[model samples]
Target: MLGPVAAWDPDGTPLPLGAPRHREVLGRLLIARNRVVPVGRLVADLWGDEPPAGAVGAVRTFVSALRRALEPGRPPRQPSRLLVTDGPGYVLRAGREAVDAWRFEDIAARAAGASPHAAVALWDEALARWRGPVLADFPTAAWAGAEQARLEALRLDAVERRADSLLATGASRDAVADLRAHVSAHPGREDGWVLLATALDRSGRRGEALESLRRARAALAEGPGGHGPGPALARVEARILSGTGGSAAEPGGMAGGVWDRAAAAWERSVPARSRARLHATAGLLRDLAVTGAEGLGEAREHRRDLVAAAEATGDTELAARIIGSYDVPAVWTRADDPAGAGELSRAAARAAARLGPGGPPALRARLLSVVAVESRGDAAADAPLPRAADSPAAEPWRLRAERAADEAVRLARRLADPALLAFALNGAFMQSFATCGSAARREVLGAELTRLAVGHQLPGHEVLGRLIRLQACAGLGDLAAADAEAEEVDRLATRDERPLAGVFTSWYRALRTCETDGWAAARPRYDALLATAAGSGMPGLSRGAAALVALVPVMRGDGLPGPGLARLDAGPYRPWLDPLLLAASGDAEGARQALAAAPRPPHDLLQEALWCVLARAAAAVGHEPVLRRARDELAAAVGESAGAGGGLVSFGPVARHVRAAGRALGGP
Candidate 1:
């Protein structure tokens, strides 16, 4: 039997035995309806600290009386006819008309539809019958306290709504006053301050508005995410400090309902007529957009659909919450037009403004940042932007890497659909580590990574599984495993460019000069990678590799390697190609001094430092500072556009001069 719903039919005549104790227990049971109300909890709520002799008997007696009254015509032997037995207690299955509690909820839902005046009037009328603290007319027990809290929460809701209507209708001052009281009545809530601030700001009292936000922040910092503030309040506060919104949250990359396959999810999950899949789907979408769901797009979408569908199935309260996105940092990892990037950033911000409370905060923040960064014209991202899309000077091996890294970030926050959000994040992070080469990031991405591996994403979780092991192995200094992961990455490589794994392979090969011989030697696989990377434009690390490899082949000779040096200077790729050119000329003294002018890290790993050592030995070039900068880039390689983990590393050898002067540039 289903549990009791809120009672309706306010005019129905009251019936039966007048046992106060039984009425108290029945009210408690009705409130908790479907769930088990433990014996200890019931007793705690029933007797407080003072249970009389045989208090247990008293409870049984009350149960017996209530059953007899509710089911007078039923068999005397079946007490469960009125209250079904459950774990340690009983479940009351009365109709809504027989239970006032459920009826209260119905009234709340109806309030959303009513006119301001009608809504307030209707709820006030309904609330008038809450009648001395629900089940409160009985003993002061723990269960009674819990029941009171629940009903009080509803009462608070009424007040909040009243305030909402008032604010919308231009009674901002009144709304603030009412909300202040409402917040007090429901202390330590994040939404309260946001609401309070909104009302105050609307009323033209800006300082107090900010204060409200501050209070909320402080309170929420303590935990439970209780102090959930709304975006409107933050906007209001922003206006107070500046003409425009202050510190406005940056946008994300994924646009609005564009990705929302809500309709599709609904058709698939819901039943014939009474189907409720939309509710579940919407909720899941909201959560995926807001919290850390996964690294796959489809998984996130499915979860969102499930949430929406569930909400459609009579979970109005849940449905009401299913809205908007999170501020995951807007960036346009997609190497498209700058104008497009700007629009994407703004859209991301708007989407985040709509997000309520969600779990994927890290992912959300990252998404917004991706958009914002892109809009800023991430010249710092892949660098050499001018040559990226169409420069004969581009490197082939890095095309996929640049695209993959940028795409991964875009995809990460780039979703309104839960599954897309997850897959993208997974791809973004894995690709980020692989191309950028950051071990620290690799360390912290586990838990969220695991979710991507689970039901949150793909059927096999195979890609993510491999990616994680790859990250772990890299972090632990397991070179063998790292190389093993590289093998897998190679197996999966395709023609369009696999930025994630492909970049990992290419960069690793270039970093330590590992593939410098192959690229510099017979075939020019590395050189081919550079020449063909035109479609998506070269990524930063790829450009770095081009310059680095150009210096490789020139080092194949003896003494000063002068003849090898001539190969590089002859190419039209001169001004922009100076770094590699200077190093390979064996004017070791001249090159080191040239680099000393700008001590930024060149692309190669320790090879830069190795070049400095070699330059010092050659003794022709003089300045040590340039060598120092080159060495710095080589050794400490921080934040450079190099791979971090997920199977990307700098494993190439001493091609610092060899590959540059010969293959990539011209000769050999």
Candidate 2:
């Protein structure tokens, strides 16, 4: 029986199935399929080492009930035709087709030899017979285990075969969606992941295909060695990466052994699109292995060669894919090669556009986000030499960046994948933080990003999310909450191999320590973290740490640092730093001028700090206009920084600071 057991009389009308015990007896006999079942075995199968007294009598009574039910009009002396007393027990005379399970098995056996489309339909019909588990009402029955396992295997096989047919029909996107659902429901199925990867690659979502392989490898690693991603999964990853055009080493520095195995497999393979990409990737890796800037230089040359080769072969897809994967020139922000970064950004935008809208939504989202980030960086790099409070060219670029982030989030939400959604949210967070005029808006975005990161188990994202919350708390003057967020950052930072999060956490701790304890007490720790950050290769953190290290004396009402610290770019903090430095030097007019020149970003903790410094300077100099400006800015800043979404974060501290400024300025 495929579901609950039932019976019908010869007249094609339903017959009462009887009670649980009666059904159990009937079910056992039906399973034996007319074979003689011994009375001792039936009793054991029914009770399993706990047979009550009169169990045999109970069996006989159940048999009599089934006999009357199966042959309702039989005469008293006539031998039963359905339930027969065979040997010492009973047998239910039923044909093979009388059992739905038997019918399914027969159809499944014959379906394997049919055409792909026909086979899928037959399998669907076979599977539809199963309403639920075998022996639906008897989960604990010992007799159900082996049969349940067999039927479950058949169901999974049918599902896999259906996916195979869909793939053969060129419905790869449909197959990808179906296989993802199957893999989600049955994570231990290696075949499901392999097929999903293939489908993803075929659909032009190569990045996602590689990500699926990584998931498969992680899953397989839980088993014994050699149990992880097999050759098919590995080949898919190699094929995907061959077009990525990232640094020669695998992203996150996957072990050399993985590439070695794939390379070996490719060597034995004939020339194909994937094989050509693999060869190009190998060339890049060889160049990267040369070491130093010379190696980096050679790697760039190799990438160019690959691009040329792809174009020559008329494989514009591979060319566009490779170009899209190039890193935004990070060094441009160092003022070393801003022009180069601009050129690369423009180049990537052009190449990415060639792929058009047919690419997967997630892939398209990634391309948009990358281009936007690069464009913003290019604008920043080209900003005037003077720390001009504001740049006329920055607004449109920031708008473009925000639009790109919004589009990415829209696309990611459409996909309904937690990882991709978190990624999109993270990008939006960065964009808002970079472009928003109000500090409160950035704080709200950061808080939302943190919640998403924590909920999704995204460790790296959690770090960034918590980092923003920490900064928000510190800005709003909520030391306790900031400290708690700091502790969380410390915890999450250890989960990542990169030192980026740790450096940020350490920097925040030093700033909090400097405020509670004196600068002298915080300096040593700041110095240590700065040293670590300098070697961390994360330019933004390294630069920020160094600037903070240089600002300790200035924050203590001393003069600015000479040479090195003076030359360090303060980034967004420059607007605030200029006024603070002018105030420290006792130049009221200069402080007023600097404050006037400061850019008014929508949200910035440093702006509050600057306003406080200016209010004090204005009080001493008796500049009513300057005092009025500081009081207004601080009041608005306090208002915005009040809540977790960027309202006064450290309400108590911010309130006290604003009140003190108001008092000094002769305000309410």
Candidate 3:
């Protein structure tokens, strides 16, 4: 009867209720559940405000008919037991469990406090009993409306609870998908957004977490009062910002102070039993904000407490998450410690598996990329830029990382979330850059993402997208485009107050100056850029600037610097440049050997420049074969003109010089 009325005889044969009206009467009585439903109210519900003059008599006739159907063998004068008439109305005698709605509610109430895994099963069973809304076929019936609303509300609560259980079980990705739908349907619920944001952050999509908070605020803004985001929403934003190394500590200290006060309030106000997760989160944020290992110890202690508390609450999923969070630092920082890195990666993978097969692609991609980076070995101090990508065919781990990044891109695109898309695109682009050397694939992706980010007004994404495009352009030997894009990046960075934007763009400027005006002309700019980068306390950019500084002697055709190759071993470019310096110093044979032993050059503007130098040296040494190969490879990498034109300064002059040398040698 929970879904539709089903009456049967003792022998399991169908027993027809007299008519639709008779069934309606029985449904009303069943819904009443042993309580008196006055005839006056029944008449009004069955017929609305307007009713026939004989409505009461008609209702009585239907009730009598229902009684007869229930007790077919009753004596002529016997009173009914199942459907009995009171002074003003009729009542149906039935236990609460006899009604599916009542039973579902009862079970759901009990399951809320049960172990999460068990509760998930229990809630699924309870929710399964509800085929649809209560009395779904009779939507216009007055008695059904209130009950329908009440039942539906309970259903939503059960869904939310089930999602919470999933999250506690380390099924954050699944939880995120469900909560997205839930919030779309019920945007007024702050808890849904909180859960969604936490799940995103846990899945390693920090940008998505902040975007979720913004969505929440936007939803709430459409509410009656038109107020800004609540304190809870702000807390979630603060946590995300802290996790991502964003500016949580605004100038004048007000914003950071507010976040501190809010964290304190949550700790003090939330029940002690429920505060473990909050404490762990706060501690982690503090650890991220503080330099070195100052806050790490305390953060570790909080994570331990959280794991203990989650296990105590029978939430194995939550315990797994706590452990996963504890391993994040090691995952990013353990490249020098392969044993520890492998152990952490394996542990994270196991935890994700417990969340089931379709775990968060973003999280999986992050872990896989970390493994890829570790496998690539330590960054060459001279190679200022991170290895952009690794070929999937290179090694087993590399394949896994590429596949994971691709999957993340697919998933993020399907989600159509700006922040998530940006995150996924960066992963995909990095893979492309590392393996293929910033080809058309990465250039197109970078341009498309930059446009999308601009359209969406996402400052972070815009900065990233612009930088990606600029880098790709530079790699493609399109310095004119790179210069324009660099300017835009600087403008956007200033607008967004993202100073790191200027660091890379400044390096490009120095590169351009050295290529067109020679190293002597660009030396002061490089020096100033290096100083600025170092002062910014950003080690990567500083390393990049230093790498550029090491190239001054090569650009000026002055051979190696006075300090020699050892001091000039600035990064990835050193191997390619050493040979050119050797040739310049009249060691043509030695230069040829160095070029022969050089690593496969990255397909970039700088590499093209090196190829030009190699070609010139090959021509000078009468190595016609080497000269042809260098010329052909350079043309393939940077277009048919040997990377000339397009206002690009670097390779054009070098390529011309090499070609002039070839002509002088009677070589093509």
Candidate 4:
């Protein structure tokens, strides 16, 4: 580590760190350094959601304090020491001499090609300088989290690379075991799984390697929940698996290099293109992707290349409106980015508006829908986004995305495409539920959704948010249909790997196990969920997902018949605990009434399913008319779900619930 110097002095006398706010502002600036970090980031990171009313003034005051402290003597030739004021932001000018992290990155990159032993040595030296959470004493500021996550992810990368060097040089078994623990410690990370899988595969544990593949698959499937190795990881896994007797073929091209030759030919043809030539070339590439499974990734790269060419021609606006397609926004909300999340959303909307037509009709529609659902109109969820609609035209991308969604829906309507319209509607529906909490609208739309979606396969390019909302419908006394939809989720989620796959499976299983005795079954699902949740390391969403799922067990059987619901005290769901408590304390009737009166479902299906159980207990108590009404509503739901089947159980616990309710009420 570089010692405190006198001239290039990081420690001439230790400048006053200043007051709390000032310390915070200085901390943010110092962490980011000369990169022009925005003012909004400073404010958001400083105070989060509830920044004080005078946050701007507060920030300026903090900046002034940083200047005074850092410039103990007369000011240097520059604006100030360390923290330099820049356009609409401040830049910290530490360089390598000032920042330990900068030095680590520089040294680590150089070590990338070094010998395994030397590389490990270099990286270990670079890594050892960490105290507690690099900035643990710092508050949970916006920029702080961003920088923290980035640095942590980077450090993890370094660690993995060191392990890789060790593995490659045959010091891997112990190295692999260490990596596996780290990978397990940090689930939903691609490199960890990749390294762990490699280690396990080398140890003659291919079965475990396959399981690691499942972890990678799950992590990747989390849908921007984590940046779990997009296509790059896919390529790596294909290489690994094919080598492990899975038979994927060499990296470049599989079909005797036909696809590679075709890809190269198409790549060459793309640059020197007339309108006619461009169209013809695009057609050839699409046809080629359809020709074989192996060429799809190459075809996608070609697609990106074509889009780039369009950009260079200065007709991007024209290109997007003609060929660009809608895509899912990043799942992170724009609140994730305080300064420009708005502008980012506007640009996305405008571009989507323009390029809303190009891309493959179905693919574009689904892409746009998924992006809308993900971006849900928020930008900061920090998920990877498909490229924006070709950037042309002036549209506002504010934090609120109803407008963007409206635009996407408008585009779908303009095309008069049923699939796209449904696709777009799903996005709008999510926005409505997220923004306005409207269940009736979803119910009305649910019928159309069922009609449009049944037996129809969605295009490969899509998000599963729409499918998730279908679970919401079932929670609203729409059991029969919910059962069918849950079954579909089971099928879809079976292939899911870690996070969402686990969430979906838990939801599906918990819903199917909808009885008093079923709680035991629910335990394993919850255990699986807990494991998945721990693997995720994203507590808010994971715990939130888990807390919501656990509500099912809380309300099953006579609405918390005895002491059965007492064991749910070990979690953090301010939203769910109350209803479970109410049910467990023999307030079954009250719980049912409260749930029915509310008409709103909890964020998790578990809670929604609990509502059903509670309502049944209410019916068993003194509300004959209300009970009959609930039954009738549920019976119609079943008939609606069953279609010509007329209120028969479709085939699951949900079906059983409806049937049990109908028989209890002496209804058809």
Candidate 5:
């Protein structure tokens, strides 16, 4: 199962597993994880859509041969034990220890939580189970491809993990040869390059380490998608170039070593620590923080410690950099933590003040950009900017954010660094929520960001740029371009193992289905998107999806169930749903009052969908004023699909909503 799918006798001599088809039958049963695989499934799996008249007979013959070979010493009248006949098919009753692949998987699973020494031994044992390519004898069998790929990925991961353990055990030089072979065999694996370079560098061959990184970039560029060296590799190269001796591995690969080096450097005396070392550590920690939710708390704690240390040393630039290093991809401008954002914003301001007016413009730009993004926290709502009386306060914050973003971009342009420009462009795009033409502004910024990210080989920023473009495309009604961007987003997310990046893509796909078909048809897709979002720890996306799931009945003019209305009221989209829910509940006056008091939604991705919901609610309650307002706001987007920008839900064509509002207002 681990390699060629062959069997051996108990004493060590190999037992011939009959011919190819016989082996395939055994392999199929084995792949079922000891469950019964019906003869019909085996025949279909072997022969696909078409099968011969004697296909069932051929399958039985193959299974009989496999049974005989597997239980060669069984009594003539005894039933087969290893490959026993079940109701309609055969079952491979092999124990876990009897199968190499199962044993390998068990070992790898255990190695995940083991100490370095133990992990290395376990990974070694796991790798030893693989003799060659998985299911090598069934190369042409379509059924084997997925399992083979899964096993191969596990093998490669084990190899990398073993190297990481070796590095941790201070045997970096010993891992060099294996890592070199790894990158050569799997050029597209960014982690392999990082490990190989780290091994070379730790072996006192800095030149070769640098060359390995260059080769990695070249190899990745030549691969199928022409992706550049990913963020982890870029951080590794930066650390190596800074001479910080930081471990060049992803957070999940060798997090202990990376964090230990960073902690040691940060604890050093001010005079002893170089700015380059501080930069390297900060970059490493920043990448770790954004890797997933598990590391976020620790990364934030370390960031605070580093900030305090920098403040003690009067290193304003370092403090500012540490405070502003969060570069997670954001769709909505709302802050996740209002209190934390305020604290960081104040810290950044203090750092800037300490630096005075003539400090490094680049550092100042970065601090200002962080402030701009953080100031979006008028409240702690995870959804888009809510419409309320206090929303007026958010207006001043939005204005201040725009001002700060403008200055940041100007300073970034002056510095002429592509990375800085990319950062500034992100802030600019985030703050591009002015009353009019916001989507156009975001589209332009998105294009510039994409170009800069591509030119500099910043794959993370490239994905961000594409996400911005994707939103812009959807908002601007360029469904074709939006579809392409969604496809590319999925590609990059898959290539980089960034599941969070695929959340938006999943949302867009479901929204497209909703537009083409109807809400009933798209319900399953939205449900799946909700699951993905929740699994990825994106509460805002999940909340919005849950709200949309509840609104489907309202859109269909069906009675809103109690549980559905409860879910609708629970999310941040409550304001947008209030009027709809009220009208559905037969509270016409309450519905009209809610629609009248509802301030226009912010000009973000969800604006169109929110407006459509409001319009429908107003029409249901005969609120002419609200209907006319919805009509006017949605007029320009007549040809577009509502909710396209947000990718959460859809109300079909915007024209439908606009026309409904117009009819309700006694116009067209």
Candidate 6:
């Protein structure tokens, strides 16, 4: 049950299960963990949306085979005690110790209340039960998805808990290797990053700790939800930068001493029912704090429980905070979950109302900052721009976000708290992105952040500041500064074991070569960058690089292969690249249609390069209207190189594209 579905005899010999279908029956029963699974549910799960005429009969046959294998020695007349008939279905009747997965869960549950040393041993014993992925042999079965995800999450939690125990026992160095592996495999897990950084910092590897935080920020930003470093990472980073060792007292600051002390006091003073509710809320918050994108569904469940528990405690501030703290490090701001963001916004507003004018300024500032951040919902800095008519609807939120950010920064600065100021400044930066022409503003914000971060010795914030500055430099077409910043980023990334750190620098350099030399000369560089992006878990970068690699043949007039064209169709740059590919393939009308339908990418580091590509495509297809549009857009950065702005792929100078579009439109 922990790995591939199978059974073993009393002496550890493997017992042969009949067929795949028979094994699936056992697997389903085992997943129920000794509970009854109805025959109808089993049939529905096995067939999915369409069941055969005799699916119930097939299910019974499989169950019969499973029963035979489980009780080979049972007398013919005696009723089987193991696989007994229950209401509506069959029950496996396996005890906790009979199955590895159930035993593992039991051990984990016990470990929650154990001391550090005992917890370490228990976690080790539980983790040792896993041999591979859950239902390893049924990779594509629809029935396996939920159980696999649940068990895998449990396994991950076990590993993290073990690391926490190691940290608690002052074995920080011992925890680093496993934590590094955990973060590498599960880069999106903010808790993994937090624990890894804490372990590295406690081990006196301060540089690596900062690097881990930086990588965490980048990895989270690249996800579908496009979130920044959430509160958990931010708090851990602040603790590390303040030179607070990851003592057993803090252990990554996951649930700090303050919470523990307060909870203990409440237990002594409050009613038992209230104390129970408090304890439950605390447990839910801990779970929420550690969960990332993969566990968002679970996080939502915890959020609901915490909200209910918070209300039950009748503490207004606690309830507000609990409701506001649904800050899983994913999909918080993305358009896909508007209801979630709206809930958070309402929570923050409620918190603000409760705090009143006399509440702690820091708390108020933090709340304001959260509001500012949330106001940018669906307007992610790198997201594609909406149509012209939709722009007006977005302006009010942007202005409100700006106001909130300004006030938050003012309050933070008035307090002169570095951590609070960093938080405020981050919100300000996130809201700085407009529909277009935001590079200059980001450049200023980035500089201020870098200065503040450097002065306070906040290495994680410093890295983020530098990254923003690097993107701004590229957008502003300052190649020399961009190159220098890229070098620094590469150095920090290499020192800290962040494989994805050097991607930007590598892309920038390759694009430079592609612009100066030719496609043939830069082909190998693009190829290598593509491989690096894929291996570093950067699917976006990989797709961008793949598009560029595929274009090399097209640029040489050799035409793209079918697979290459198919790959091009799926990338973000498909709108621009489609026209170029179609024009090169002798389909002028198709190229024109693609150009007409293409929406402009959001104004960011990559906007100029994409526009330049569109400009070339327009010129190749002799589409004068698109040519004029491209020419006007490129004219803004005529002296700058287009591809250098985006490190992923380059298409030469902005001036060249502008001039080509001008000629196509019968201008200069």
State each model's C-alpha RMSD to the native. Answer: 22.0, 20.9, 20.3, 26.9, 22.8, 27.6
Which of the numbered candidates is closest to the native, going by highest lDDT?
A: 5
Tens-place lDDT digits, model 6, residues 190-270: 678888999999999999999999999999788656655567788888888899755785688655423553566566667
Q: Judge candidate 4 at residue 139 and give its lDDT.
A: 37
Q: Candidate 6, which segments miss by more than 4 Å at Cα?
A: 1-411, 427-441, 475-480, 494-499, 512-521, 538-541, 548-566, 622-625
Q: What is the lDDT of residue 126 in candidate 5?
A: 90
At residue 559, candidate 3 shows an lDDT of 32
lDDT of 4 by residue, 252-355 (tens): 11222334434655666566556645556556665444332234335544655554454456664545432334232112121222323333333344445555
Best of the two (1, 4) by lDDT: 4
Query: What count of clashes does model 5 give?
Result: 0
TM-score of each: 0.33, 0.47, 0.46, 0.35, 0.56, 0.47
Better of 1 and 3 by lDDT: 3
State how far residue 230 of model 6 sits from its true place (Å).
Answer: 32
For 411-518, candidate 3 gives per-residue lDDT tens digits of: 667655565566556546544534223345656887887887765555556766677667666655676887888888877666445554565677678767866687
- Candidate 4 error regions (>4 Å): 1-344, 350-371, 375-400, 434-440, 443-447, 453-470, 489-506, 514-518, 533-668
Worst ten in a row by lDDT for model 3: 327-336
Candidate 2 structure lDDT: 0.59
TM-score of 2: 0.47
Scored by TM-score, the top model is 5
Estimate every model's Cα lDDT from 0 to 1: 0.45, 0.59, 0.59, 0.50, 0.73, 0.68
Better of 3 and 4 by lDDT: 3
Q: Record all residue pairs in model 3 with backbone atoms less than 3 Å apart, i.e. clashing.
A: 168-317, 168-318, 169-317, 382-570, 382-571, 383-571, 383-572, 388-434, 389-434
